[model samples]
Target: MFKLLLLCLALLPAFAGAQEDSDWIEYRDAYRQMIWFEKYGKPKQFLQNHFRIRPRDKSVPTDGLRLTLNGKATHVALPLDALGRAVFPFSKAAYDDNAELAVNRKAGQLKSGAWVSIVTRPDGVYAAADLRTACDQLLAYLRYSGEAAGKSCAGVQFSYPKNDVSQVQFHAAGGAVTMLAPKEGPAFSGDAVTTFRVFVYRFAALPETGQVVTSSTPLAIAALLE
Candidate 1:
């Protein structure tokens, strides 16, 4: 029994090494899958085809998922059906309107309103840390001016188009804010490539929340940009 115990202890290092190798392989596979999604336009196309929820059907279901944002105090419940279909409160019109509001607010057009900025980092900025620094500065400015709600934000990550998959991480904590990986592919700058897009949330509540009681389809999806 003592000799068998010693043998098991001696093999522990080899077992640990094998586990590390397995973990690395799985990580690499995730990257590969991300690349495949980009190549075929999976998530984007899939949403367009399958999960296209109409405005008429955008009612607040009783058994929906409840979520909070801009601090845990602000309660928000979203409509998520058993079919795994999550109807996001986003539309082209809404995005255009909020984007205009954001621009006007930045240019001193609006006196008192909320708006979020689409912060883009170009390839000229080599280091990811430096790019994030720029975003952080912009975020600080928005927060100090009282133009933004909570700090729901996301950073962009660019990867080689054909060789490997994109590496994007999505993290959402309690009510502070949520961060998402950037959409993969080539974003053309005027002369260079855009590395990533950092979307900063800075908006008041949606326009139609007063009339609605429960968590209905989102009227304004500006927050979902994160």
Candidate 2:
């Protein structure tokens, strides 16, 4: 009887740990994948990198989803933006601990990945010349990374949340605003979410005059390659 009781006491700590660190992926894995962007020597001043929590199940509610890094030496809460992304944190301490990226949601319902997007302006305005340059930059990186083979930078796509009726228009130097038509499309290329208000501003469709693109609140402005 005494031996059985001793065995149960030894197992108590292990059981408690399993429950505490539930629903987690190794933080070292995330660090290794995301560290590439930081080390890339390419010109990407107009771009930003984020860590995304992708819900495989479309029915999962992410309204109040929370993520954290769990480790003996590191504990940080990662806040998600409207697009389910957060500016990835670079923590050597977290890396050393081989921590866990755990979420409040149930396990096996979601996956995590990296996202690269065009940098947005606070005033929701981007210069025509700048947009072209940004698209070209993304194309170069994609090609270097062996993606979008034989494709060229065609335009830029603005995406907003379903609740936001946003607008994207080009403002000519002389003062004419041309509104880009809004259509229904997914925020990302694939994996659910096919109802965001999307607006595509193709360079070929409009004259590349000295202009600026204005927006209201775009969750993301993706580089359109074709």
Best by lDDT: 2
Q: What local distance difference test score does each model get?
A: 0.24, 0.70
Once fitted onto the true fold, the runs of candidate 2 whose alpha carbons sit more than 4 angstroms away are 1-22, 173-175
lDDT of 2 by residue, 171-195 (tens): 7777777888888877766545577
Model 2 has an lDDT value of: 0.70
> TM-score of model 1 relative to the true fold?
0.20
**Residue 130 displacement in candidate 1 (angstroms):** 1.1
Q: Give the Cα error of residue 57 in candidate 1, in Å.
A: 22
Considering every candidate listed, which one attains the maximal TM-score? 2
Model 2 TM-score (2 dp): 0.84
The TM-scores of all predictions, comma-separated, are 0.20, 0.84
Q: Assess candidate 1 and give its lDDT.
A: 0.24
Worst 10 residues of 2 by lDDT: 1-10
